[model samples]
Target chain A: MLRIPCPYCGVRDQSEFDYGGDATVNYPALDASEQEWFEAVYLRDDPKGPHTELWRHARGCRMWIIVERNTVTHEITGARPANPAHAEVLKRDFELETT
Target chain B: MGRYSAWEIIKQGLTGNKGWERAWRDPEPKARYDAIVVGGGGHGLATAYYLAKEHGIRNVAVLEKGWLGGGNAGRNTTIVRSNYMIPGNTEFYEFSLKIWENLSQDLNYNVMMSQRGQIVLFHSPAGRDAAARRLNIMRLNGIDGELLDREQVMKMVPHLDYSENARFHILGAAYQPRAGTARHDAVNWGFARAADQLGVDIIQNCEVTGFLHDATGAAIGVQTTRGEIRAGKIGVAVAGHSNRVAQMAGVGRLPIEAHALQAFVSEAVKPHLDYVIAFGGIGHFYISQSDKGGMVYGGDLDMYNNYAQRGMLPVVHDVHECVMQVMPSLGRARLLRSWGGIMDMSMDGSPIIDKSPVEGLYLNCGWCYGGFKATPASGFCFAHLIAKDEPHPAGAGLRLDRFRHGAMIDEKGAGATAWHH
Candidate 1:
């Protein structure tokens, strides 16, 4: 099991959190073109090396955090709060009520 | 290669059995070839076989980073079925199933294709409705499908949990009598031997490190660990490593992800489970009994994007719980072994058999968890694409541009996510 170090709850088991997908994707503007929105949402990257992804502390503090880890090695390099600026955009686009 | 037959076996047994030759030749890599297939799994070997047999292209090379069939070709649970629902997927997989029906005779090797049947059990009303829709589509396409009631399912599989106090009540199931399993290793060996006899070089341990591209950005050959080998055309049948291999030719990202899907086998017991059974509720759990009496089964993907060939404990735990919930009598079965195979999960859950953006480079990938069953058709269609410079009718819908064109063949109606599919 991956011991993810949540920014809020410290290190915890992987089962305690829900895997939110790629964090590097920046939500497009509300009035952006459909193609742009599709690219932003569907055309996500599957990087082989270190990647920044979202992880929700579902069984812990109930906060979303960005965790930078190597996908190949499954090593967590860093953790931080999710981009606060994209909170509303994520909520609207991803149907995520919590950030 | 020596032909395998009952008479030949008897003669060899009587004469000290020293005349058996290796299934394939281990030859040094040549300077060049007419075409080069990058992966030596079942698909690649079958591609070479068809390229020689059907297309009359005998000068081919199949390069493998390791031994043939060591990848997912030998790692899957060996379930074969064509009960797909979508247009593109349904036709293509049915073609594959047809090919598999005659594969042993065509290759002159016994693959042990068994049509024991399969059942996908449903718990909720919505799930049953979805299964009914899929069965309707299958029947319309000439594929056999039967909706079995709870009592019928109980008669089919008496060991299934049927108690009134069960958490997920078994409502009904979608049964496909033609679906079954094949001997996985025999398939690899058969294809390799046939391709070798047709003069296709089966080169193992020859890892392609980079691509040899011309000034116009067309892949002309590959630089491998055994040295550089040029080819007029290149076909990549690498499953999970498709994205990494494409990067060697300067192709950008792919709509594929590599995630580990693990399989498990239990200690051999008495012959019990006769049919391949699958759970269609929450977790993706499927089980079947091997010929040796071992219970071979697997669950969902590890739920992470990684190339690791081993999975974590949570999936194991989840699979165990589901298996016990379904077949409570098997709770005492001892676990023997488990291994993972990296799946090339596509954005739309369907496979891609198309020419790459780079000229002279063909791609056959994004098989997800269905590669084993699609081996023959994937090879036949991919060989057609690589040889004729056009997609075969059976696989025409699996275009690399489908994701951009919004023509995605979303088999499970799961949008865009690799693991969800």
Candidate 2:
């Protein structure tokens, strides 16, 4: 089982979390071309190595986070909150704790 | 190497059984061929077999990184069914079922196909109504399906958890009488031996590293670990490694994801279950007993995007819970072994058998979890595409541009969530 370290809920089993796929998907404009919407909605760069994806701590804090993990080995490198504002808060809180 | 008949079997048995020959030839990778099939799994071997047998493209080569059936061909729970409800999938799966029906006779090899039937349980009235509609569609398509009530289900297959206080008690089931199991390795070997006998080279340890493209960026051949081998046409039917091979042809992102699906087998016991059981009420779980008495079963994908041919502990626990919920008697059954296979999960949980964007390249992948059942038709249609450069009638709906046209064959109707399907 994957041991994910949620930004709010230190660490927990993967069973407590839910997998959100491909974090790199950039949804196109509503009035975009059908081709652009098709590519964004369907196509994926499902790599063999490291993949940056989304995970939700559904059973714990219920916060979404971005995790960089290897798709082949299931080795997790790091994770941060999905919201940039929450990530900024984490950085600031860490700085305050250290200082 | 020769025809396997009753007379031959008896003669061999009487003569002390010393005249058996190797099933297929181990040939070196040739420099060129009429068609090159990358991946020697069941689909690829079947493609080569059909290419030679049907299309008369005998000068073919099936390149495998390892032994012929080393991949997903031997990794699946050998259940076969054709109960699809959609237009695109309905015809394709039914065509595959017909092929499976005649496969043993056509190949002169015993595939051990047992049509014991498959029962998919439904929980509530609404679920039963939906399943009834699906079965109605299937019947209209000339596929056999029966709606079995709780009493009929119990009578057909007993020992299920049908207690009064049980959560999500079995209301009824959609039973397809013709759906059953086959020997996985036998399917692979049957296709390989048949293809090899038709003058197709079955080359092992030939890893395709990249593609050879012409001036117009059209794929013409492949750069393998052994050497550069060219072909007039290239058909790739690699299941888990579809994207990696497509990348070799410089075909960028695909509408697919590689996820690991795990299967488990229980320690051998007295045969109790004769039919394949599918229960999606609690969690995705399907199970059937092998002839050796081991209960072969598997559940949903690890529910993550990983290519490792191994599963995590959580799915094991989850699957065990579902198993107990479905069949409480199996609570004491010990797990014999568990293995994983990387699945090519298409965005809409359907397979694609169409020409790749690159010239002279044909793709036969995005099987998701339905690869095993669709092997025959996947091969036949892929061979049709590679040989005639046109989509086969059964596979005509399976196209690379379906999503662009908003024509996704979403079987589960789950929209974008792939594993849900």
Candidate 3:
């Protein structure tokens, strides 16, 4: 079983969290085109290596956390809040370091 | 390939079984061919066979990165069914069922296709109504499907938990009498041998690294680990690696994700389970007793996009919980082994058998968890498209651009999410 680290509630069992899919998506404006919205909703990347995904602490503190994990190895590299303030900083740092 | 018959078996018995030849030959990769299949699994081998037998294209090569049937072809739970409700899928799967009916004779090999039947249990009124609608659609399509009431389900599978206080109490089920399991490895071997006999080269341990395109940007060949080989046409049936292979040909992202789907088997015991049974309640658990008496079963995907051919323990626990809830007696059966296959979950939960944007390049992928059952029709239709440059009637609706045009064939009505399907 995976032990995911929730930013608000420390590390916990994977069953306590509900998967929320890719965390890299940026929702378009309310008046964005249908194509843009469709791409944003449906055209998500499925990379083979490390990925950042959203996981909700359903059975715990009820906070959305961005968990940086490896899809192939299932390794937890980092975790932080999915709140915009912290999420943007983490994502940018991840992209910069990886690139 | 030598003809396999009872007479041959008797003759071999008399000769101490020494006259048997190898099922297929391990041939060296040629420098060029009329057509090349980029995966030596069941679909690619069958595509090569039909391309030679029906399309009169004898010079074909099937390149595999590993040994034949080493991928998802031999990794699935092996349950075969045609109980789909959608228009395109129902006809296509029914056509596959028909092909499977005579597959052994057609390929001159015993595929061991069993038709014990399949029962999908529904636990609630809403579930029953939805199953009724799906069954009506099946009946309309001339495919067999019967709605079984509580007593009928109890009669069919008496071992199931039927107590009034049981979790997810049994309400009814949809039964498909012609649905069953097949010997997955035998299917792959049979197709490879038949295709080899029809003058197709079956090259193993050869991986395609890149594509060869002409000035017009049409794919004409591939660069493999062995070497570069030219072909008139190239068909990619690389299952979970569909997006990876497509990238080599300059075809970017696809509406597909590779997720690990795990299956478990219990230790062999006295025969008890006679039919393939699936739960339609909260969790996605399906179980069937193998011919060897082992209970082969599986549940939902691991709910992550990973190309690794392995899954997590959470899904394993989820499956065990569901199985124990349905059949309490199975709680005593110890699990012997567990394995996972990379499923190419498409956005619409249906397959994509169409021509790639690059000319002369054909694709047969996005099979999700249903590829094993659709092997025959997937090959037949893909070969037709590669040969004629047009979609086969059975696969006409499975276009790659469906997502862009909002023509998605979402069978489970799960919208566009890959893992939900």
Quality class of the docking in candidate 2, CAPRI style: medium
lDDT per residue as tens, model 1, A2-95: 9999877789999898887788887788999987766775554677888888887888876788899887789999998888765566677776
Q: What is the per-residue lDDT of model 2 for residues B304-345, given as tens digits with 9 covering 90 to 100?
A: 888899999998988898898899899999999999999999
- Listed in order, each prediction's TM-score against the native is 0.95, 0.96, 0.94
Per-residue lDDT of candidate 1, residues B39-107 (tens digit): 999999999999999899999999999999899999999999999998899999999999999999999
Between candidates 2 and 3, the one scoring higher on DockQ is: 2
Using lDDT as the measure, name the better of candidate 2 and candidate 3.
2
- Candidate 1 regions exceeding 4 Å error are A30-39, A42-45, A88-99, B415-421
DockQ-based class of model 3: acceptable
Off by over 4 Å in 3: A33-35, A83-99, B415-421
Per-residue lDDT over A15-93 for candidate 2, one digit per residue giving the tens place of the 0 to 100 score: 9998988888877889999888878878888899999998978898767799999999999999987756545664576
The per-model DockQ list reads 0.48, 0.68, 0.46
Instruction: Give each candidate's fraction of reference contacts reproduced.
Output: 0.39, 0.86, 0.51
Model 2 CA deviation exceeding 4 Å by range:
A83-99, B416-421
